[model samples]
Target: MMGNRRPFKAAIIEFNPCLNNLNDNIKHLLKEVTEAAEKGAKLIVTPEMATTGYHYENRRALKPYIDTIPGKTTAAFEKVAKHYQTHIVIGMAEVDVEDGLYYNSAVLIGPDGYIGKYRKIHQWATENSWASWGDMGVPVYETEIGNISMIICMDASYFESARIAAVNGADILCFPTNSTGGSLSMLQAWAEMNGLYVLGANRSNTEKGYHMIGASTVWSPNGEKLAETSYIEEEKTRNETTIIYAEIDPAEYDNRSKRRLQSRQPDLYGDLMLHIGPWDFTKYELIKEAEDVQGNEMSNCAALLQYTPVIGDKKANLSKIKSLLKDTAAETKPKKGLLSLVVCPELSLTGPVHSLELTAIQQLGETDHDETVNEMQKLACMYQTHLVFGMIESDSHALYNTVMLLTPAGDIAAKARKLHVTESDERWATPGKDIVVTSTKGVGRVGLMVGYDAAFPETAGVMAVNHADFIIVPSCWHGDYGKEMALHTKMMENKYPTNTMTTWDAMARFAQAKTLIANFTGTKLGCRGGSAIYTLDPIYGGETPIVASSDKEEVLVVAIAQTEKDCWFDQNKLLLSRRTHYYRPLVKKFEHVPMLDCN
Candidate 1:
């Protein structure tokens, strides 16, 4: 309706479940669906485990609420759908009639009858106890309304689930979730990146001390939020329920999807299907060979420093970097003498400004031949270590948030501008054109990305395919650093957190390469540094991941031996296993798209 002719009206229901009471929940869902249909909603969606309720005491206790599809619950919903001529999607505890196994699943019903279902693939914390792992992968259903797919709760955390469905020709992704603030960022990301509408329905109210915060929402392929419920009210009271609706044209998404597929570099996504296996050393032995190399011969050691720069002070910022580098060299000279490389946060030279006025940020920017870069190059040569830093670059017409990599010889190796520009960045900087991986004399292939660029996997995939030994990310994250780290730790657990495309996930997803991420510290320019070094392969008999100070200036120096062997993938098999032709759907360029702000 907004831009296209034949619009499809879709509705999402957000309400409190009756808690293990299947009958009452079903009745409530049916009422909501009926109301949605009367209001002209062609398709309606409900929250995860809507029928049976979530937060079960035990798997055995959940048996009574679980039933097979086409059973009593589906039959009831089907009758209503048929009467209203509306499509319905709801989550339930599904039981396999033959094997007696249960699954956290979502069922789809149309006017005709039972359509299809999607079992939750990536189970959350408590789910693994009750529901068996999902057997069916991502499945898309075709009907008169549109090509629909479902991803429940934790499944939305996995970008691959949404990607696989989109690649299989899904126009709308219906997500039934029993989650909180953590995943809302990803919901809109999936929609805009895949060029499809996303309908997210989350449960509200408290269940057995476990609170479900509902912010049921919908987004267009262009990354615009069509409608969203109040997350604050949902968390406060059970009386607050939202049944929001939006009108979308499937043809718009179809055209966008075609453009998206045409722009993908599928040949570079070989690691998309790779399983880094596990962190347990049972499968592969640690390379003890690096230990025998002795003294200054260690080529793998690197340093990632957390620095805070004075805003708008280009001279002060350069002095701070020089001081940090000098201190690092002095401290490490007693050990391995010098680290192979050193990395700093984004906009290191100019500091960071969250404004676009040319006068405000332009004065801080300099040409590639500016004295700031030359000084950094001299430092790289002085320490005989590769130096990577972030700065604002001016090229006559535009200013850019750029990352520059300098060789140990004090010569420029490669420079890349940030491709994913933030709203604030657009006011002053232009986006980079492509993902570039530059080879170094001793560092193997090195890839450089700035700030938000790490949020997109395609950028990392391009670097990974180019055989980068490790990727350096210089970021100045703006948020509650304490909360972000806590959430990251809780969400990741001990499992190799590589299932999604977030900065932390990308580290594990591209485990073959050591990912060194550095950020600015303190609240000066609104950054609380949480620098980390991620390596799947253990170094020096300990887990390779380490987090620096949460809100203070710190340096994370770790020994990452340069290895010719693709330790995680077995001779670069991760890059070799990709089905290049099948990934055309992801070919479309999504870098320049600004991220949707979370409500």
Candidate 2:
């Protein structure tokens, strides 16, 4: 029981923790533990602040409720662990008797004894009241089944914590959370990104007037929702407490664990590590963008298809894209001379987004000469229209997030790789170098960006400098619709928060460029489906700038005039603003500075 290295079942308890009532909470928890162990779970996990509950007034109010590491709470769970021959992770408010500090902590109790504890490093909004930031760092505990590590609720928000745990050889990243919506995808993404199993134990029901949405779930390393218990389902079943069970095999994660870390580009990610705070603006040279004269007439009609992509199914994905292209071509045949290009979502061939198996991705990865690209090229030639789509491009050693442009003659006119890649992308694909803008027979100079590249202003800035008349964004922005939309709104506002502008609109209008954004739509990816076409001026005669937008799968065809008009937002001259030298912090590395120091 102390040392067994075999695949075993695990359980995550989703229950309501009574505020400041450890007795009732422990009794309910033990009941779940008994049932889980009876059902053959070798490891069991619980939600954050499982015994003491979350939300305390302050340190003074919380200290009385906080207990020591091997205090009465763990002692009780220890008995259960010993009785069941299983390991248990229990979350509670921890009081360091020596240091006299409180922490949001999770303790690992094995059959042998108390294994270890992990303090929650990243604190959420209200948690700063009593909890001190964790100092133990991310430490892993080796057991017979696998190497295990614990991360409290807010810690999962930062990808670095999970990355740190995985880099240190953690097979299972156990999470104790009091989280609700918008956090689920982040958990799933973390599991897929790190190639480690995740047990997300979230609290359910109302606590002191605050409702915690319970969706306790377990995710496989590949981002598969192995088992889950949602609040809606539980309410229908009239179940106040639920335990989601899963079977984990450490061997399943071995290959990806090595591959994902190997693919990380830390050298290019130094900017991410740099933290910025309020600074003196007068010290830096501030220059407004110079006004630009409207360029020559460059009108071209385009179609943006917000179709769903099938994950890891290359043949099926290609067939879908081809069918859509053919259908779109037929619909626009009467105006064939007008429609210049069709844009598809990122990784349209093998799925715009996926928490895919590394081996499957490598096998499905296609080279430029592969049949995948040739088929798309043929489609472009047959229609006599340019086509741009995303796919997994691979060479001998690496995979790339690539967008391929096909001319009407069936030739690969341009290939642009995604420069800014997410953790999910880094799991399998290598980040691309350099922004590429290429001239098409009818489409004018077009710049390509994939997914998160939209987050960086410099990406669009560089493309704008190249005289691009149009930018095609192929995105795999997957998550809950409302939550992802909120995130996008926040990201778009970070730089220009006071203006309340969409990043895509700002990027397009400020750059004096038109944009055709193609996004995937489906429950499979859980991505917020935001596909639209934007121009400087409204074509439909509405105040809104977007020409066409779709929340679901649809063919959005928009006809643009040949003349490129100066963008409405361009009147502000933000794009032409020449403070390039003053923006050194964006490209150069800087030490982590507290955005707001409370000293």
Candidate 3:
């Protein structure tokens, strides 16, 4: 797809449709599209439901605005697309005359006329009252500008909708949304995670009681904010139309998609298709609460110990681990019928393998019955707390980077090998082949993931689909990596000041699970401690308070209750709303596609 073609310009229109006035809305959209096309924008997109207002009470209230795909809206936009020799994507309310059903849809038109259409597959709460679930699967259209795909507002909340399009060879994703706060972060994550350009066109002004937050944005494949609009309420209430533009060169980001696709392990993602509702935990009794537990009981406490370990020094690292465990136990008194989980960074037992030789690294590996495990088991039993930490495991003729969960019963509850090994681990470690999730007495089901595995969404998605209440990541994430560096530069340039922590938070929110991340501090391998517990607010999405984070050694603890989990599942049925049938491409075997340059 990347030839000698030059970079092409794309535009997004932040529109405010007049309620029950289809004529006025269409006229406004046409004027904006024509203006963008006149300015040499090869592609232009509008906000979702651009022909009709977003919030209607029921089908009867929205009935007047419903029309066929090529009936009037597409016909109006087609003239502009053909006149300027460009492509246009517009969102509208569609009615299937054959069945008399309604849908929230996005239609694409080029110089040749109507290209294709995509309905809102994942509907928001209000949309369920009138619109039918999208029957059309994700579609990508071929054009001279790029291979383009469209997703409505709520569809961007789930990674699967965008992942499927990327896997099918989509270079750019057009997002037509009416979402408010926290949408910018979601768009950036989607763009970086799938390695594709994302153009978000969000509406302005208030519809009914729903106030649109107008931060229409353009994001590059590396998660850089190429362009964006105002999110101020005062500005949005003016109902002013805004147009933003960006120049995209698909060739520059070809390697990112190549590496992302090449690193995927689809065989481990079968659980994604399972219909696992959140309430299924109760039926399965995944988290066995104590019999004496009261309805208003305080939540269990979890802690993260962030510290740099000496390379190849197992004795010092193990001693430091014991000291930290002892101090934390003394501070936060462990109570009966309550759970206490403590996590440490990756390879906390034997330190990182940065400058160590293969033979030296192998010698640092510990077995199940080694003194290192014995000492940790003693600490777990003595403190009456569940302990999670990473270590280099020595097996028969092989060494693996492994995370072990030691229950308060003085036994190894679960051990997971790193599934996605990094460059350092590749020198002396073998990649794990499966995802691990285990049911603890008080923590519900706990999923285990090592450092690099957190970078892949499928690892966490599989666990959440299998009903994991909490996901623990033992990471040694560095700031010097190429992708991380790019993202950091972009965040600073935009005054956002976020890091890879947003990635972890986004994964937790999409999975509807709480995530506890433990990372090493100090300069070893450029790892700066950012260990924190990420929580989900059903109304506000992922929120990272960063309970305890620093560039130095520290012990961070936070109380997590069952109420939060219950509230999330009760209010937001995110897991139950998944359209699994359309996720088949995610689990398919990988093959090189040179034309798409994803090898």
| Cα RMSD (angstroms) for every candidate in the order listed | 9.9, 13.2, 3.8
Query: Compared with the true structure, what per-residue lDDT tens digits does model 1 show for residues 77-123?
Result: 89888988889998889998899889999999998899999888777
Error of 2 at 518 (Å): 4.6
Ordered by lDDT, highest first, the candidates read 3, 1, 2
Between prediction 1 and prediction 2, which has the larger lDDT? 1
**Model 1 segments beyond 4 Å from truth?**
1-5, 233-235, 254-258, 279-377, 383-386, 389-599
Clashing pairs in 2: 288-577, 289-576, 289-577, 298-562, 299-561, 299-562, 478-527, 479-526, 479-527
Per-residue lDDT, model 1, residue 571, is: 19
Q: 268-367, model 2: which lDDT tens digit per residue? A: 4433332322352421321111122112223346778777777777788878877877788777867533557888888887785456678888887888
Residue-level lDDT tens digits of model 3 in 1-599? 33325788889999888989888899988999999999999889899999888887799999888889878888888899999988899999999879989999999999879999999988988889999999877887777777889989888767788888888778889989987654444777778777889999987688876777777888888777889887647343848799999998866447454366767889988998877565575543543442222243465777788888887787898888878877777777754234478898999877678688878887788799997788788878887889998888989878899999999887999999998787778899999988998888766678999988877788888887766778999888774221321221222212322333556766777777788889888864577777877666423432434545447788777665544544423213766888888888889886665554423
TM-score against truth, every candidate:
0.60, 0.57, 0.91
Best candidate, lDDT-wise?
A: 3
Model 3 spans with C-alpha error above 4 angstroms: 1-4, 182-184, 234-236, 277-284, 287-299, 334-339, 480-500, 538-544, 547-550, 565-572, 595-599
